[model samples]
Target: MKPVITVREYARLTTDKITEPTLDLAQVSVSAFDWLCKLNATFSNAGAALVQLENRCLLKLDNYVGVLETPCGTRLEILPKHFEREDCIKQSRVLLRRMIQVSLDLPTREVGAADLQNFDAPLSEWVMGRFLLALDHLIKRGLRFDYQRVEEEQRFLRGQLDGVKQMRQPPGRQHHFQIRHDIYLPDRPENRLLKFALDEVCKATKDAGNWRLAHELRRVLLEVPRSRNVQQDFNQWSSERLMAHYVPVKPWCELIIKQKIPLAVAGEWHGMSLLFPMEKLFERYVAASLDKDLLQDARLKTQAHTEYLCQHKGKNFFQLRPDLMVLHQNKSWVLDTKWKRLNSSGEDKSYGLKQSDFYQLFAYGHKYLAGEGELVLVYPRRSAFDAPLQVFEFAPELKLWVLPFDMERGVLLGAPEGFPLHSQQLQSSEQSA
Candidate 1:
C-alpha cells in the first residue's frame, strides 16, 4: 500500500459514500486513527490533524509533510502539497547539510545509499530512510562510545565504606555504602540516549513496515545499552565526540534528543518526531543560497542582531533580528523571509501582506539601514503569487521589494531585478561628483 496520501483523499476515504455523508473512522486504518489522536495530543494546535469531519479527520498542512505511525504497526504519511519530489528532497538535503555544518562544524558526506534522486518515496519515508542509512554507516564505522565513571549504592561490608558513620548502620544491620566506582562503562547517558532513540526509531520503522530500516536500526541498537534514563544528559564534550565520528548524524541526533519522550501511550512508545519549522528552514535555505550566489565582495548575515528598536530604563529591549542582511561596499540591504501564501487577487490586497510585517520592515529599514538602502520582503513562490510583486516605497528613499524564492530552482526568483544595485555604483557616482 502506498504510505503517502493527500489530506483531501484521506478525508474522502473516511467519509460515508452517501448524499448526506458523515465521517466513519472505521473506514480508515486503525494505525492512522491512533496516529491522528497522538498528533492531537502532542502538537495540539500546531499539529497536522486539524479538525474532525464527523468521524473523518482533516489535516491542515501546506509545504510540509508528516510521518506518522501507530502502535498497531500502521504507517501513514501525510503530504498536503504535491511538490516535485526531487525538488523537495534536494531542498531537504540542502537544509540538513547546512544544519550539520553549522551544528557540528563538519562537511557533509555523500548521501550514498540514502540518495533520494532515484527513490520514489514519501517525504517522511525518505527522511527516515536517509537518517537510518547515515546512522547505520556511523555505527559500522564504530559508535563513539566513551568510558564513563559510574557510582552505585551497594550493600557490602568489604568495599569502600561510607564516610558518614551514621549512614553505616552502626554495625547492626547490613552496612551499605555508596561507592563511586570508576569502572569504564559504555553505558553512559549519551550512549543510553542514543540507544533509546534507536530503539524508538526501530519500533516506528518496524510499525511502518520499513523492514530494511528497522533491521538496520535494531542492529545498531544492539550495541548500545537500553537506558532507563531517557533524559538528555550529554555535555559538550560528549556531543563533540559523537559528532566527530559521525558528523552526518548530528542533525538527526539533535532532533531525536529534542523530541524523544519516554512516556508510552497504548503500550507503544510515542516515537520522536523530526519536524522542521518551515519558516526557519526557508530562512536557512535562502541565506545559504544567497551566500553562494551573491557577489564575492558582498557579505551576508543570517539572524543578524546589530540594533535594538526599543530600550527600557537603562536597559535595551525589543531587538530587531532580520532574517538576511546583505552588505556591500557602502550600502546594506535588509531582507526578511516570510513562509506564507501570498494573495492571488489582482486587486491591491498588498498581496495579503501583513500590516505588522510592513511595520517591522519599516523599523528594520529605519534602524538597520539608517532609513535608506533597499528593504526587501522575501516569500516562497506559491500558486497564488508566482512572480515578484511590484516594488513599492515605504518612503521616497526606502523601497520595499516583495520577491519570491523559488523552491524548484533553489534560487531567488528574479534576483537581478529584486536586489538593489551594488554600493560600488554609489561610490563611483560620488567619486565622479
Candidate 2:
C-alpha cells in the first residue's frame, strides 16, 4: 500500500517531492499516476469540477474535500482549506467528520475531536469503521426478519404452487413442484444491500480495524446474499418502524455503495472517491447548526425560494434562493454561507470579500427582507479571519453582517442587531483572536 497523502483543497500537486503542502506525485506508483492522468483527461473532456491539470506534471484540486483512492492503492485525503496549518490535519479530519454527520444527519452520536486522536485514518476508512460499528450494534439488537417471497422447484409442494409452471413441466417430472412461497427469513432486501456494502468495505478499506470488522460482519451476513441490484433493492426497501436501527447504517451503505460524490471520474479511474463540494457542505453545516443550537421558537428555512430576480415574457427568471432564512416573531432575516476565508490586513481593504457576493447579497436583502432587515454572510472561522468584519450598511434601515462561524465550536460568532442569537453563540468575534 502506498503511503496516504494528505492535502488541503486547492493545494498544488507536482511530480517531484519538493515541499510541504504540494503533493509529490512521485510518491504514487506509475500505475496510479497513469490512472490520475486518465482521470484528469476525462475530467477535462467532461468539464468536471474536481481537479484541473495545470501542466503535464502538475494538478490543481478544485473546491472539493474528501478521500479518493487510485487503483494502485494510492490514497489521497483532501481536507478543507481551513486546515491549512500542518498541525491541524487530524483536527481537520475530526471537524470534517462532524460536518458530514450534521449535514447528512447521520444517526451517529457526537464524535469529539479528542475521541479520534488515536484513529489516524482517512475519511473513507473512518466512514467504513462507522458503518461497521452501526452494523455491529444492529446485529446485537437482532437483525430484522421478514416473510420474503421465494420461488423454487422442490420435491415437496409448499405454499401456493405455480399452476402454469406446474403444467408446463414434463410428464416424468411430477415429483418436482414449482412453488412460490413466503418464507420468514433475515435475507431481505435491506440486509442484502448491507451485505453488498460490507463487501465493498472489505474490498476498499485500508485500515486494519475496518477490514477486520468488515470480515467479521461478512461472516455474520453470509446467509444473506449480496445485493444484485442496489437500486432495485433500495426501491424495495421500506422505512417501516421495525428497522429503526438500520437508519444510521443505511446512509453509510449508500455513501459507500454509491460512492456518493459529484465527480464522475471515479467510474473511469476504477477507484473510490467520496468527495463533497466544500461550499455545499459548509452551507448545510451552518444551517443545521443554527437549527440545532439556536432557533428555538423560530423557523429556519434553507434554500428559500420566495422571490425571483425579474420577469421576462410574463415568466419568472433567475429565482433567488438564499442559503438560509430565519423567521421569528413574524419577522425575517436572510443569511448566506460562504466557504471562503477572509483577510483583514491586506492591500485590498475589502478583506478578500468579493464584490459579486455583495451584489448577490444586496439583491437577496432587497427581495427577501424588503431592503429593511439585517442580512448575514457566514464564513468559516480561521486564524487570519477569526473576527467578524465591520458591518456594511447599504441604507439607513438595511445592513449586512459578515460573521465568522467557528468550525471547532459549532457557533456562529457575531453581534448582529435584531438577529436572534443565543448568548453562547454570540461571543464577541474578537474573543476568538
Clashes by residue pair, model 2: none
Clashes of each: 0, 0
State model 2's lDDT.
Answer: 0.80
Off by over 4 Å in 1: 1-4, 8-64, 70-76, 80-114, 144-185, 188-190, 206-210, 213-223, 228-231, 236-243, 257-269, 295-297, 305-319, 343-349, 382-387, 416-433
Question: Residue 50 lDDT in model 1?
Answer: 32
Error of 1 at 352 (Å): 4.0
Q: Give the best candidate by lDDT.
A: 2
Error (Å) of candidate 2 at residue 317 is 1.8
Q: How far is candidate 1 from the true structure (C-alpha RMSD, Å)?
A: 7.6
lDDT of 1 by residue, 1-433 (tens): 4343323113343422234432211234545655655555654454443334344443333333344444444544433232324224344444443433332333346453344345555444554555566677777786555655555666763345556653655565545666654554556565576676566566555335455666766765675687674444444325454457655665555454553211112224564333444456567767766776676677898888979998899888899999988887787888899877686567656678899999999999999988877888888777777777788788888888888776644567644333433333443467699
Off by over 4 Å in 2: 17-30, 41-47, 110-113, 150-153, 157-180, 259-265, 424-433
TM-score for each predicted model, relative to the true structure: 0.66, 0.89
